[model samples]
Target chain A: MKQFSKTLLSIGTALAILGSAAAVQAETIKIALAGPSTGPVAQYGDMQKIGVMAAIDDINKAGGVNGMQLEGVIYDDACDPKQAVAVANKIVNDGITHVVGHLCSSSTEPAADVYEEEGVLMITAASTSPSITEKGHQLIFRTIGLDSLQGSMAADYIANTVKPKTLAIIHDKQQYGEGLAQTVKDGLEAKGISAVMFEGVTPGDKDFSALIAKLKKENVDFVYYGGYHPELGLILRQSAEKSFNAQFMGPEGIVNADLAKIAGDATEGVLATAPKSFDQNPENKARVEAITAKGEDPSGPFVFTAYAAVQVMSDAIKAVGDTDPAKLADYIRKNEFDTSIGKVTYDEKGDLTESTFLVYSLHKDGSKTPAAQ
Target chain B: MSEASLYFLQQLINGLTIGSTYALIAIGYTMVYGIIGMINFAHGEIYMIGSYISFIVIAGLLGMGMVALPVILVIALVIAVFTASTYGWAVERVAYRPLRGSNRLIPLISAIGMSIFLQNYVVLAQGSRDVALAPQISGSWTFGDPQLFEVSLSYMQLLIWVVTVVCMTALTLFISRSRMGRACRACSEDQGMTNLLGIDTNRTIAMTFVIGAALAAVAGLLLGLYYGVVNPFVGFIAGLKAFTAAVLGGIGSIPGAMLGGLILGVTEALTSAYFPSEYKDVVSFGLLILILLFRPSGLLGKPEVEKV
Candidate 1:
């Protein structure tokens, strides 16, 4: 009887400890860092991860939000839509109420539907498709500008600055790539400049010889590609090999160090329209230093945007004094928050009231200079 | 040449270059099926591992400030081939050997499982992002009038042709004359009979796998250099296309795979040149269906004869 009593007492103590641990876990707010951690474009996901982690670290160091700690859980979607939907379901199952990613627009759109239905707040830091916000979901938000904004900026630069005789547009046929291509085409059409050919190329295809041959035959002077770096890198290199000599330009998706590595010297003079370099902002010196001090790159276009996403979510949670999604959503939509990307204000559609995209000439060394307009 | 002719010629050259690499990958599939009568779905992963090995070797050499391109190429190729052959042997020993003589679907499923395992393994080891290699081969030879249009062949494309032709010629000679090659043919014809003749059929089958893997590694190295980029998922598509080529040439036939690869490559190139680029895949698959509808045995494939 004495031994039985002792065993019961130990079991009670163990249960108490586990219960306390569970309580402590409940006290913290969990934000799911959902994005492509493994795929062709996972490098972009790394940019998002670095930004979110840095922001969470800084927030915890400042005594957390509403005196409760912030926790981040990472989920890999591989920038694939089906995988993103599965990830969204898993995040919901895991009871994470806040999310900071789904970087590719294709992945973000499908995942956003689940978040909206579940009343989970999601702020995509990199996806730029305008159609994402066109549905006007209350919980769907993004720190980055829409593709419509970037596409028009690119079209305007092409029309007003580097006027060419003939233009061609190609896309990878995904939601993000195809939508951005259409936006650019529409923007150019509005400016009375129509592309000679608007074609979609299958992603993951290595050879672009036929495409190059057709481009050469069409006598296009400027080629606008809407895809990520891998495909565009091959296209550029193959075009160089064929001596096609057409001026190649693409959106921010193709702007990365990998592009130069793949295309070698052919990457010179490639034009891209991307979000302004927020790390270069003098006002964010300390924030930039904090990120760099941890040996993370702060120059990626998605970095500050992802940081601002976490910041806005934490600020709203603190201001609302709770983790209620409806209340936080209402509070975030109505107010402005000063973030690493300068002041951020969301409109009714969960898009920033103002966003700036600039045209830059990318160099072979992976540096960018503002292209003359 | 007229602009039209030049465009046609350019597409043909491009197709031939891509097709040659496809042929290299297809030989692995055809030879394995010919001997074992089971599709080694994991063969694609072997090719992927080969590419990763080459990338690591080249990147390491370059990082160590080794600027000798030829030396780097030779070293990477040798290591990739040797490592990939080892993987091929292991895969056969582990995945297929245990399931031999079971339901045929059993080995196919096991092969698929192995493929998934290898892909995830690579993803965990080397990461999932595309790794780029600096192009060692550059420049091209142009023909026709530069003012209208030019048909150009890149040095990388030329290397692909030379390497593919040499590999194919060597393989042909080996199969026709070498003792191991004769053993492989005997095992493929009748494994039990070859075993009764005091020849180790298992070793012959294993040798066939090794040869196929070596060829695949060569393709992996060549294609990796030509594209200047490689990712974990590259093998999936390339493998599917190569499988298609193997089937189109009649699975289990060596020369048929080569012809099928060239045909498929040229068809894709011409379709993309004339129609929308996205439709190229559709047209190529459609051609495959049409051909199969007429000749279910596939072009150059001998009709299977069953003995009751």
Candidate 2:
């Protein structure tokens, strides 16, 4: 009996050594895509994951960076700050030195802090709130334009182009919505224009008739809404029904395809400020096709940005020939990369060095066209 | 008219439009509470189901041909009422029936679970994004000149008021005159006594759910028409507001619920009009607290009396 036990112990020791040897031989680089993969905003996460995975797949297939195949992991934060911090710990524990995620600014802000503290590089693809970069985190970067720039650009466009007499500013009373609204308001005020009415809305509210009635009473020539598409769609539809004769303008959160579905004919001529169109880049044709071939829509939120994020990270790793967070961060800050979304470069603050925001209008057939400048 | 009065009048019209919906949904809560002595938390999901049904019926019929607007509304209403009532009946049978004899907390908890289940069920069947309905009802009537804060009332608002008035009258008569409603009242008073008197108490309870569900369907249809958008989570807020209305009106009293709903709605509209719109919900909830403090039995609720 003792001899049988001894034989079993010897076999287990041999298996353990063999497992270690096999693991050591496996040359793979691990990265994580952390975001709200579930919950209400999950579509955004799904978009990022699709773009990141496709980029990773193309990279590894073409011969991985320095011959080390990339392996991706996903952690769902549900856009909650606490959960995002927890995911940061998980990624760190798993020995993943890089992250491409945290779609919402609220989640990105704290998770970026954790990543910075833990010596991990995080490149969020979609969080646009300016404070994300303003925090002075060396290892934290975003591929998207900040809301401050986007919001100010929108104010200039509205004042110079649309040129309405009076405007009403409406926000969904969230940090993102209120921040964008305030920035636009400041820009508008600087341009010697002030909204006749400013209103706040509950995020999940369906009824906006009362608010619509107020807007009608004010007789504003334009309504600048800082919220997501769901409420914007309802507000626009209700406004049209009441014949308010006011044009609607919103930020990128209102660029969802579902806007047309909810607002129907009302979505026509609805204006929004978004990052310059990725589809317009002729160089991105092949990349878009590759994403579409994977049965994922390339036009989704952050699909191109996420692709750029992965491209920049992988290229930086290849350039440095190492995955040290500080080296990669410094390398990214100093270099320019031609990506699916155009040439990308970052300032010392890790914000995009050159970001452009444009105005787009929704067409009747559920497509967006760049509005006349 | 002065701009202030005109604005106040417009806010009043807005309040009544939303109030009518809260009133309709509040009836479900009051009626169910009257008979079973438990909050039908799933009542909101029943409203949501009704809205989805209306959306399907309207979308389906609109897809078929160019039907008259009135015809489409009637057809959608009939179908949504039938379907939503069936759902309400099933909810009671499956989630609440077996637990009828259990502790009161069990049934309340069961209703909450059923609420969550129904929400996720809709999310699965329909995608989570807001489902925008085509503008089936449009146009409005202006009460004053557009130059100075005109008080405009939309056709949808007019319809909501008409429906609420008609439903309230019909429901009052049904409770006062109908045989089933009498059984419901008796069951509310004393279930054991009603059973002793040969009333089918179980059937009455089920019918209560059916009736409340039908009212919720009407509310759902009108809300979709007014908003032109519906999502799976609509029921949670609407249900919460309606429940507050029911409690404010007196939990077991139908008239109280209607009054409570109107009051809640007007308060929300007025507060938003006069104060920061963000405080609208806060003010409404504060009103609830004040009412509870001044009158624990609510404006019309009867104080509980124990007998030896």
Candidate 3:
């Protein structure tokens, strides 16, 4: 009887051991997808969610990275700087080693410091304030081109192509908007184009007749807006209403399909500069298809950047065996990966070394078509 | 002759337009406060809901081939006002009625709870993203020359201001002359006494909410038309500003709300454009602080006297 009991116990222990071994073999890679999943800019944040979800779907279909299925855990930051740090703390507490975003520049900048201290590797797909990386963190990298790239391009285009004798510069006054405005101002001034007026407009405002009146008084030939589409739309709409008929220009934030809708027909003939990867780029065909397959339109500027962020981070994780954030971050800083946008290498300052910008014009139909080559 | 003077004038006009919106919304705040003595923090969410409701109805109608501008606007306005009015009644029933005659603080807290609940509910229902509002009308009428000084006015902005003025005038007449309007004034003056005098205070309170909510809906429609965008949480700050306007004018006074709204709107706009964009909010809250410190009753508001 004793011998039989011992045999049964041994069999039970073996079964338990086998179950534990299989469970360990089926382990998944946990990647945190933190951003404003619920807030005003959730439109932009949704892009991050869609990009991460699609990347995970594709990676898992290909058996994931290093035989582990990539799992995305999302957090809502609501684009608030204080809340972003809280979300970062929550991400680290949950043992999430790799993080994907906090969409806005303000939230992303502060959150980057938290990830750096925790040794968690984070790549911002949308945050583009140059000052974010100017402080220098190895873990921080953005997929899209910076405002400086677009800012200089815009200023140069205005100075050389448009050649307005008088120019007015207006900003939304956020870090991304104001900083980019400064960059463009420098570029325009260097080209010997003296601006007629410089102003800053608030986001989500309803009127701009005062700014128009000022422009009218200055006899400003052109307007340069360093802001998002919301204010730019209102400015244009108001400009049309009050009879201020000068040409308008803005940075990538306002250079979207939605801007036309915001300003309606008032936006026609307005020029805005963004990345060169819009329609007519043959390199992005497969990537666009990949995005479309996930039931999302990659028409927005950040989708490719977001998708690339996921790809780069996963590659870095694979290159560095363990999940130590510091090691993973080091691996990311050292590597170069080919993306839908093209081969991207992050410099020590975590800024993309290779970048391009394009200028687009609003057509009469309110469609954004690339400026004639 | 100087550039700065022209700039200031332009800024002043911008502020006035925005202030008009604030005044319209402030009517809701002041009305609710007068009738119930409860600060409905959720009033902002009501404004947001009004915008979304209009968005859905308009977008749905546009989807079904009703693209005519005037027709769409009229139908959307009717639907938004009706739905928003219904929403106001529902809010009173759920958030306000339960706390009726309770400590003012209790009702205020519930108002905050209701505000959060509504914002989250909209987030779940509408998805947490700013819905793009495609305006039906485009182009502005240009009066000045393009090269030297061109002054233009778009159809949408003109429409918004005209609609606001007309609605506000009608609201003022309705409150002063209508049978229900007199009862509302009585209730605000003395709810217990009005109840003793054979008025169904409950129904009157609900009606005030409905009317206030409809006014907010008009403002929401105007916002959607002007900016061509709407999101679920858009009402919060606007509601606060409108409330400020109401207090600035005189909490229980209808005309005061109008004046307050215009003041807040114009102040916000001018600050944003002239000083610095970041200072816009600073200007708004700073004025609010100044008003509180100097004249707590507001620009046109009268100090309330507790009745025996």
Pick by TM-score: which candidate is best? 2
Highest lDDT among the candidates is held by which one? 1
lDDT of 1 by residue, A1-373 (tens): 9999999999998799557658879568999999989999999999999999989999999999999989888999999999999999999987889999999999999999999999999999998778898897999898988767877777888888889899999999997788788988999999899999999999988889899899999999999998899999999988887888889889989988889888888889999987799989998788899989999889888888999999999999988998998899999999999898888898999998886577889899988888877
Task: For candidate 1, list the clashing residue pairs, or say none.
Answer: none
- All candidates: DockQ: 0.62, 0.58, 0.34
Deviation (Å) of B176 in candidate 3:
3.3
In model 2, the runs with Cα more than 4 Å from the true position are A1-142, A286-340, A343-345
Candidate 1, RMSD to the unseen true structure: 7.0
Off by over 4 Å in 3: A1-147, A266-269, A278-354, A362-373, B1-15, B60-71, B137-162, B266-288, B306-308
TM-score of chain A of each: 0.71, 0.77, 0.73
Model 1, B103-140: lDDT tens per residue?
A: 99998999999999999999998899888887778888
> CAPRI band of model 2?
medium
User: Which sections of candidate 1 miss by over 4 Å?
Assistant: A1-144, A283-353, B64-67
Question: Residue A290 of candidate 1: its Cα lDDT?
Answer: 93
Worst 10 residues of 3 chain B by lDDT: B143-152
**Candidate 2: tens digits of C-alpha lDDT, residues A83-124:** 999999988887789999889999999899999999999999
